[model samples]
Target: MNRLVQQMSSTPNRRRRPDPAAGEGSGAARGSNCKNITIMKLPRYGALSTRRDDVAMTTIRVHGWPVSTWTRTAAMTCIEKGAEYELVALDRFSPEHYALHPFGRMPVVEVGGLVLTETPAIACHLDECLGGPALQPEDLPTRTAMRRWMSICADYVFHDVVRAIPRGRPASAEELAVARTALERVESLVGDGPFLAGDGLTLADLFLAPQIANAREKAPEVLDGLGAIAAWAAGIEARESFRRTAYDPASV
Candidate 1:
């Protein structure tokens, strides 16, 4: 997770409930009384899905730089699950930011006192706690496949493919070879199914899409023979969650 600057531990005094009256920044309210916590206003899905009245409404605060793929992944999870959230632009080097996440990485999710450091944990929050459309599959076999793909994404796809493209200039022949192998690996894994986890969208798709997009924009030819992967990426991009979390790279 070099992209995350190597995700490290969160503050030991981590768990915190929202204080409606809390002010801005950790200094205004640290420990158990952090600032900007608000209740969620879950929308009714009519006959298809009812509003979860028993669950406490709260605003999920995602602290991260928008340009980060993982940060966008966290935010997209909120969007897809209909969780009201606020994206707090984070400068990991700041004293306050480092206080929230000791390693100074983006995507420290704060909601109703719960502080989550890892991307998967942040993305799974709503489904696990608030009760909404499941982002993870329930079937054991499919679920196992989903987890497999997610692991591949974190371990190989991002670090191998997306990170291989040189930042300021054209990728060297060796660099493009590495990226091609990574993309081809994904292409071979994605069977005839519409998504990484069979037919449904799951954490597997969410985890892989951003990295794929990054490679496409930077070194497109690495995906030359990967029509299926490109199509899958396009479908993921079409999702409203992806669009909602899209950020201008130059702005970051």
Candidate 2:
């Protein structure tokens, strides 16, 4: 989820500084090239099936922590798209994950026995597969707004959540300030809605929900102070889709 925000903020519209992890390229280069390089452009299932006649609806195995925002983001997408998948919980300190992903990242989606890394890629594929509620907005401005907020949630909220976790650590003053700013922006966008993209619930809502959940669980006070973002998050929690993908604390 932090990666998601970093990537989104690095895009053209946001015009923010390039994340070191995203590289030092210009926005255009970073956006297009980054997608091409980091993302493996697998052919759609139908395309593969038509060409080789061997494609089938194989189970998807998601490698991630149940409570992780990224994991829930991917899970919510799968559930929303009506796809069936299995979750393979991963340990951050595990040597076994070295071969699976060089960085040992979570929410790596394996479909039809082939692995696909990166949450953005997985989300895009799920949106393509599902298409009905259209997780991404079709209108240009709405699309841009949706992507922008998604990036903000990833960047500010999720990043703070990550930085706050430790044996003797809590969110710093700076981190709380950032969280407040993020909540402000979220309130501006959410504005008395049952979902992030207004009346229709979309991937944007799911993507942000888990991050908020993590914050609520670990630092309820922080979440409580931000009334609007808290309310928005509660609405998402009330949804059936979210409940199904709800994190299991004991297992995570």
Instruction: Locate the minimum summed-lDDT window of 10 residues in model 1.
Output: 1-10
TM-score of each: 0.75, 0.72
* Candidate that would win on TM-score: 1
Worst 10 residues of 2 by lDDT: 47-56
* Candidate 1 residue lDDT tens string, 1-252: 111111111213344442212111221222222222332222331121112443236557888877677887888777777777888988669998777777777788766555666665455444455555777666444554565676687678878886788666899999999889888877876755557775688877888888887787677788887887877787889999888888776564
Stretches off by above 4 angstroms in model 2 are: 1-56, 93-95, 165-185, 250-252
As a TM-score, model 1 comes out at 0.75
Per residue, candidate 2 scores C-alpha lDDT tens digits across 1-252 of 122333444666645563323112221131123233243334553232211112126666788877778888888887776776788978775786765677878778766434566665566555554323567655434444455556666666566554454323576677666665665555555555555653566557777788777766655666555666777777788876688887566564
Error of 2 at 155 (Å): 1.8
